[model samples]
Target: MSEPKRKNRENRQHGDRAAALNLFPLPPETEARLVIYADLLHKWQKTINLVAASTLPQLWTRHFADSLQVQAAMPAARIWADLGAGAGFPGLVTAIRLADVPGVEVHLIESDQRKCAFLREVSRETLAPAIVHQGRIEDILPELAAPIEAVSARALAPVPILLGYAENLLDKGAVGLFLKGEHLADELTDSAALGTFARYEFSSIPSVTSVSARLLVVKARAG
Candidate 1:
């Protein structure tokens, strides 16, 4: 890394730590695991296109914090499935956070073999209970043995198509929590018009990164 870029990463890390302490504090062990995961991600990014190059400087805040924030939405969830888990955003982060909890399992579904290899290495290194499923999201969902408590995707697809991929899981009693960018309103509007998720109540948590970003939480509607 260049001097300027290294300095920027350091500054961002410092800021993200401060913000995390105030808003998203983790247990000591969990914090340590995240440090390990971040280091591995940085090392991997040198050759592979894991995350976007532009966001590398703000990896802590933009990716880690953004991914970690979802824990608050489903505090008691034990089983999670992350669709299109490229580079293992929320999936790996969640697994690291819940590493100490018994029966906790995170399934990271990614189509790319290279990304799956990275996910497997991270899981092994961190000792996080993550199951890497190397296949299409559609193909993997049906093969899961049991219903997941939560399903998530980050920067994967539009709301409508995401819902389509997640429909089976949702019907099996899994709640959907997706990380969406600035155009959430437009996406939600477009999805609603498609008449999908009619029996669902959708809510959102504003991302810590910026006001334009949000974490959309979906659950079945009550009778």
Candidate 2:
């Protein structure tokens, strides 16, 4: 990298880190861990497609804060399953945030081996309470016996598809907390019209960081 470009990237990262701290305001230890996480992400991102290149400049608000808000929505959930845990949005972030708490476990389910490696590296370095599951979501969900209290995903799939992926856990009484975009209302309506999500009750809360985003909460209706 040229001198000017290298300096510019360093400056951008410093600014991004500052913004992350300002938005979240976590405990000192948690803040340190997230800093490390962000550093590793930036390093790995050079070779691996961990995040969108466009969003790289705003890693703090766009990715970290977005994931942190999901954690904020369900603070009491001790055991979590993050499906399609691409780049470990809410999953690894949840684990890091809850690492100090007792009995907190975040299951990160991803099919891609490379992403799993990345998740593992972050977990090991940050000592985050995450279990990286490197296999198909369908294949791994059945084997988990952690009594997960909640299941989460971000930019993974549509409502019905997510519910389908989480059906096993939902049937076992785990709540689903999915991060979604502005079109969530239409997605719900379309899924309802198709009766694809009849078994689950859906509700949404606005995202604290992004006006165009929402946190979709799902639970199975009683028989």
Candidate 3:
């Protein structure tokens, strides 16, 4: 294809994606919170790399909206648990967006103390009403005070480890909402070796310009 044609085609594809996706329109408060989140991340990143420095420009599409997609998926009715909730992507965003939904709660789980501190501050600054856990999946899942309605992860770990770590919560009726990139098919094949599940749905993240932005939702049926 000619260069101009290719450029136009790319622009059209981007436009289509923007239209088909329910991307979050920036609310004044949400926008402010995102600014705060960015500031904190930059300050911390001087010592600890939270997200790839190259990804800063795409932060809104790749991080916030990507995670925020979860809120719209469920109609703001379910309890959510975000595993390896590093830098608080969907978990913090979900908490912020789902704030007014009665009985909605989001749990942000992380093992690193520094990241835990970040998550807590995110909740504080965003008034996200999210619970931050500073421990491993094994350390906290079994002791959860109540069953969770939803569980999710993003760039957390491979599907196999995610499935293993979240097994307990999954057994307690939690549904999975995980974000995966281009290699999703390969990861799913690897995870299938573990066992069987009741349902699995894969949807591309329309809000992301990043190629292969897909979210996987899995349900673990009671055995």
lDDT of 1 by residue, 59-137 (tens): 7777878888876788899999999999989889889888999999999999999999999999999999999999998
| Model 2 bad stretches (over 4 Å) | 1-11, 191-194
Model 1: runs farther than 4 Å from truth? 1-12, 191-193
The pairs that clash in candidate 2 are none
TM-score of 2: 0.92
Clash counts for the predictions, in order? 0, 0, 0
Go through the candidates in order and give each one's C-alpha lDDT.
0.87, 0.90, 0.73
Ranking of candidates on lDDT, top first = 2, 1, 3
State which candidate has the highest lDDT. 2
The sequence of per-residue lDDT tens digits that candidate 3 reaches over residues 1-223 is: 9999989866764554354234567566766766677667768878877788876545666677777777666664468888888888778878877765678778888899988888788678777779999999778877778568888888888877787888777766777888887777787777465463333333444435356667777776545
- Across 42-67, the per-residue lDDT of candidate 2 in tens digits comes to 89999999999999888888888889
| RMSD (Cα, Å) of model 1 | 2.1
